[model samples]
Target: MAESKDLLQVLWSGADVLRGKMDANEYKTYLLGLIFYKYLSDSYLAKVYDLLNDETPDDLQEAQKQYEEVMKTEDAKDLLQELRESMHYTLEPDMTYVSILNDAKGNSFNREKLQAAFNRIQESDELFNGLFADVDLYSNRLGTGDQKQSATIAEVIKVLDGADLIHAKGDVLGNAYEYLIGQFASETGKKAGEFYTPHGPAQILCRIAMTGQENKRGLQVYDPCMGSGSLMLSCRNYSTEPDYIKYYGQELMPSTYNLARMNMFLHRVHPENQHLRNGDTLDADWPTDEETEFDVVTMNPPYSAKWSAAEGFKQDERFMDYGGKLAPKSKADYAFLLHGFYHLKQTGTMAIVLPHGVLFRGAAEGTIRETLLKNGSIYAVIGLPANMFYNTSIPTCIVVLKKHREGRDVLFIDASNLYEKEKKQNVMNEEHIDKVLELYNNRKSVDKLAYLASYEDIKANDFNLNIPRYVDTSEEEDEVDIKALTNSIKETNKAIKESNTALVDMLNNLTFSSSETETAINEFIEILKEV
Candidate 1:
């Protein structure tokens, strides 16, 4: 805990320096990318140290030579091996974070040199060619004045250098990185919400997807919109089952795509076991020569982004197989849903976070919604409260899909009313998450909160997956007691009259005129009406 605490402090210091130096929008990429790089470098060094423990490699040259030779013969080019030789990064003699920081204190840290180092690191591994594609190290956004950028870079380095981030004592580095991402989301306004998903909501998504799987044997997992890999990582954090858990994901944003990959590496998820990608998932370049399938799929794709419903897509296997047309160009939410549904295995389960519009939207989205619901595999539709995200406060829902179900009804949970309020955000805590998961697992009706909607019932509602359409989310007005209410109103009127009389007596004692008093009372009443 102490080590973790120390690391957090260093991270906060680094963030403070970075905030002072760079623009709010760009700091996330630079700082998070650096932390990820540090993780990779440290992990690589640790592997090298362990290999040289019993038999000293004499020097770095011998170490590098042996590592390459051993890697060539191995059946699987392990992550550790790939790190040493990959084109994503080039490790110079003294260029790790610690080494550069040491040198910077003596002389002005060469900004070009640091940038070059970063380039070399990324270039060292071709697989990560555009990993840091979003970061513009030389961008003027940092500052037009050269002096300010240099100072900002230096401060960032100084703060990170002093931070004890190399050790995986806890999730200190990961949490700090997430915190910085959240800060960036807050500062960037609307555009920021696209890349950042708050950790709290992500937790609920994870819990919902993995609810009953804790008891199940093998629970393979995946995410289609793997922003920062936070949702997938949450599974790794909360899961009790050991060997059954595996993670896969894809992301569209280049820089965020890199961060997700780096996050997986930090969490020690091996490259061979991971299926992360940086591309448009809707077009479908899944990581397999054959049809690949997953057991658990979770995603929060860009809400209603436009895309070419390519004329050819009508014939593409994923959508055509369902005998349904691709969602219209106006909304891409159903496109992602179709992609997720196509990738799901026959015996698998999936949960996806989508905007509320998907529920009742007409045209192509409605057509696709009807198809998914009529399949009889739709398990649950959970409505989340508004303002649960980093920037946008719009309400959202998680659609749970499963190929195999023990019952014929779909469960609808109206969690729109259950949330813990923060200053500007609404969070779903452990209790809230647990209750949702419990209802999902139990598959029971909870009065007006959760209900099992029949296939016929849903079909009757015109296939609208909205919570209010199924779970009866209306508060019912608490069955107002007419007699009690009337008594309360009378008492309130009497108290107000008495207070007015007392005020009149006070004014009369000061020798005020009746007309003047009436005018004053009228003015006070007018003011109070607005208040």
Candidate 2:
């Protein structure tokens, strides 16, 4: 923990120097861009030394001849292996982190050298063509003055040079990036909440989505509103073969879209297996004509937002099957849900976090809810505590949908009370999260926390997926003992009368107010009896 703290301190110093001089949002790009450059440079350095030591002729000509021979064999010159052979690329004479830093000596303080180095890095690898596309060093958000910009760049480079990012693992960097996103969410409040889910609540949702799917391999997973790709990455963490988990998702925000893509690459999810698209998922533009499908679909889309549900979509395959009555344009909660469900494979499962209103709201949303339950697409509803999101205080729920059902009953988990309050935020610790996952796996009825709602019961309620309608989390009013309450109130009234009488007698002996004191005693006894 102390080492982690030290690492953060090292990173923080760079951020602190740029605090008032740079916009908080723009600062992340500079820091993250440098970290990625360091990552690639370290990867390059690690392999070059290995090539120099490999068994070959000490003579440069002989070694060159042997290296060429080695490259011609079947599966001989893989790009990754070749990259390890030398710290070289199709770039101008001097273009690397070391070169950029060395150039930053006296004149490099203004840092045109660093920008040139970044250009070469981006141009060298087609695989990383658009990787740093969003990191704009020339953006005005860094500040208007050259002094401020130069100072910020110098501070950033100094921090990067001081830190040993080469020795750090990708997970460590990814974790730090996630931490920064969380901090931004808190600092930016409502705007940040638009693209972020609190890490703790996101973790609980991820734990639930990932349960019972551990041993699976080559599992296809997706998120409709994949902000920062946190939920999808969490699913990867739960996989027995994490490397085999293929990620797919969509985001409407361009900045968040970039972050999600970077997150996939940062975690080392092969670029080919990642299918993140930047667009409204309800009208996904992925090459779905290929019949691509996912086995796990998890998301926490913006609570309730509007969409066009354009008339052309009436003939589209996804909404066409729902009798052409699109989910109203005012609330597209069910629209996103339907999109995910449509993309889910026959054997797949989907878990979505939504405002609880979806369960009981009337009109178009209610109609869609009825259709899903009646068709047996929904499998469970887990109620979460209020304020689980960063800026919103509204209570929410997770709706679990499945293309295939193992049983006829729907599980209802009333977990609204299973959270600890930390400062002003409600958090679900590992125990609370584990309990929800445990109950979900058992699929059995627990007295209060969980109950299996039969299909008939759900039908009787007109297919309202409201958890309280099924699970009964209403505390039972402490059993309401009328007999005991009456007995206790009567005894309390008699005791009050005796105490008042003693006070009245003492007043009379002092010749104060005998009649008035008696009346006051009677009024006090009557009020006590009413209780």
Candidate 3:
């Protein structure tokens, strides 16, 4: 764990070199894009070395010489082809990070070389197309002129080159990349909502979505609002066959969409298994001709961004089933929800993060909530603490939904106060996450903390699915003793009287030669009597 922290620190230090050159949001593109490039290059070289070892088993020195020689000749074509089939991308010998660093050390490196490398990478596969588009090599943010821009990028490359990315375990490098994204999220404040979800709640969603699928293979996990692909990747934690899980996601922002693609590759997820798209998930429907239903769907979309909510949408398949009313045009919370729920397989489970208003808001939202509850679509609601997310402190909840649940009971977990305060945000430790998961998996009620509400119970409340209504977490007030309080007041008054009498005596014992002194002592005695 300590080593991981150290590695993260080293990787993040590269960002520090660019701190003054650009904003955290912009500089993150350069830093993360370069790190991802380095990873791809290192990964390619590692595969080459492994293959070389297989060819020359006895002599390590001979293998090194042969590896360099073959990479320069047409003989390396077969190896590159095999790598393309497996890794889905290839890096030329001169395009590697090592070559860039060596040239930078000789003061011969420039932004044009990096630009060429990025162009070649994007051309290598459809997965990498426009992957580095956000990392503008010649942007003025780096510097005003070509010399300044080249120097800054060169310095960044030199710093990243110091880190041992090639030999480190895949998780170690992937984790470092995630750490940088989180740091950027913290610095970006509310804008972080566009591209990042805090790790704790993400874990809860993944675990809830993966319940009963522990032994399942070729599991399909998806996130419609996949910000940097963190939640989509979190599903790997619950599955024994992490590599077999196919990842699918969509992001609205072009830059964030690119980030999600880079995130997938950095984690070593195969290109064929990743189906990420860049567009408005609500404005345009995706996976249109492919298998629309997914085994697990997770989302942390914008809280209440406005959408068309047009009358035309009433005919749309996703919202049409939930009565004629659509989520208010002013708030599209339900629109995002219904979109994700539409893609959920009948046997699949979905977990989505939403604001508290969705639980009790009336009008169109209320009707949608009622429709879902009556059909047994909603499963559980877990209330998270305030300030738990980087985007907002409005206190959010994760609603777990199943298409056709056997039972009509909805589990409500009031974990609003179950968090530790950090410098700028509230955080849920592993213990807190596990407790919620345990209570959720148990599917039974725990006093105050959790409640299992039957459909009849919800009907009595007019279908208000607010968590506090179902699971009360308020503390019980201490009972007051009237007799004990009266006795105590009398005892306190008795002491005051006794002390006043003594003070009066002391005042009388003082000699008063002047008329003024005598008048003051008389006043003091009267005041003591009143006390």
**Best TM-score goes to which candidate?**
3
Query: TM-score, each model?
Result: 0.80, 0.83, 0.93
lDDT of 3 by residue, 309-391 (tens): 88888998889998798999899999999999999999899999999999999989999999999999999999999998888
Taking all chains together, the TM-score of candidate 1 against the true structure is 0.80
- What tens digits encode model 2's per-residue C-alpha lDDT throughout 1-531? 555556566776767666775566666666666766655554444443346465323232233343345446664446335663343343232444544555555446645656676677667655455556677766666667777667666667667666555555656666666776776676666766656777656776676666677778888888878988988888766778888888887888877777787677667677667877778777654537554677888888877888897898778776666645777888888788888888888877888888888888877677777777767888888999898788688999888888766555789998899899877678888888888888888888888789898889888988777887877666655687999999999999888878766765655455325879777766765665454
RMSD of model 1 against the true structure: 6.7
Best by lDDT: 3
- Sliding window of 10 residues with minimal summed lDDT for model 1: 56-65
**Comparing candidate 1 with candidate 3, which one achieves the higher lDDT?**
3
**Which window of 10 residues has the lowest lDDT sum in candidate 3?**
55-64
Better of 1 and 2 by lDDT: 2
Runs in model 3 lying further than 4 Å from the true structure: 1-3, 50-68, 71-87, 507-528
Off by over 4 Å in 1: 47-90, 133-135, 142-148, 215-219, 240-246, 288-291, 321-323, 404-407, 475-531
Q: What does candidate 3 score on TM?
A: 0.93
Residue 450 miss distance in model 3 (angstroms): 0.6
Every candidate's lDDT = 0.70, 0.71, 0.86
How displaced is residue 46 in candidate 2, in Å?
3.5
